[model samples]
Target: MEKFKNRWEITQNWQLIFPVIGVIALGYSSFKIANAIISKFGIATIVIVSILCFFLLLKFTLFLFKKLENKWILDQKWEMIRVFIVFAITGSSSMFIGRPIIKFVGITKENLNPIVYWFLFIIIGLIFYQILLVFFGWLFGQFQFFWNFEKKMLRRFGLGRFID
Candidate 1:
């Protein structure tokens, strides 16, 4: 317990919630993936697959954590989990948000060419992703980190003039 907390620089009890949430989220994600991949399997098989996926995901996440630790500046290591959670939420919400906007704009494969419809859908999703990323970052108390990230991304997209 002490080692886990110390590793993440968790000095306060409230900060412990992030790690717990991260585990639950990861477990749910693993189960979802396993179920989607083998819906016809028995319960035992699915559970086994889910458990396997959980470990695989854990290993992959730890690998990413270590790799990104050097690239990202942070006051505490636990904050990285929070940052990842915000990104997950923002990315999922962006697709839902874009779907409604696309329907509202009356853009559908049946009406428009499939390629054009998909192109517009992706464009709208990206726009919402940019907006939601910062919003979720602020909500999760990582505004500065994601705001700077947003700026760097925009610059790469050649939209630096709008921000500067």
Candidate 2:
């Protein structure tokens, strides 16, 4: 209980639950997608692929955590988990928001060429990602850091005029 309390101080107690749920949801989604694409490849292949995907996800999560470590308000190593959680939520939110807009605009792969559809999807998703990164950072108690980061990124993209 004491240990849990210490960790929760770095983030809201309920907030910690999100990362666990996010990781499980991501893993399940990946497994389903992989299964759909590789069902004919045999169970051994599926298992191996699933393992590889899990490791890749883990690596990416850690990489994100490491990259954002300096910007996070919490300095403890364990806080990296929280940072990863926030990043996952932000990224998922970006894609979720972008998909609806794309669908509304009737930009499906069936309508547009596959390459064009994906290109537009990524562009739209990236726009949402930039906006959501700061929003999620605020929600997770790192607003100032992300706001500065966003400003820097916008400047890099030649939108420095927008930032006062």
Worst 10 residues of 1 by lDDT: 37-46
Error of 1 at 148 (Å): 0.2
Backbone clashes in each candidate structure, one number apiece?
A: 0, 0
TM-score each candidate.
0.96, 0.64
lDDT of each: 0.95, 0.77
- 70-144 in candidate 1: lDDT tens per residue? 999889999999998998899999999999889998998899999999999999999999999999999999999
Candidate 2 overall lDDT versus native: 0.77
Give the per-residue Cα lDDT of candidate 1 at 150.
99
What is the clash count of model 1? 0
Estimate, for each residue in 36-83, the C-alpha lDDT of model 2 and write its tens digit: 879999988887787778778778766876786676566554555655
Collision pairs in model 1:
none
For candidate 1, the per-residue lDDT at 70 reads 93
| TM-score: model 2 vs. ground truth | 0.64
Please name the candidate that would achieve the greatest TM-score relative to the true structure: 1
User: What does the lDDT read for residue 141 in candidate 1?
Assistant: 96
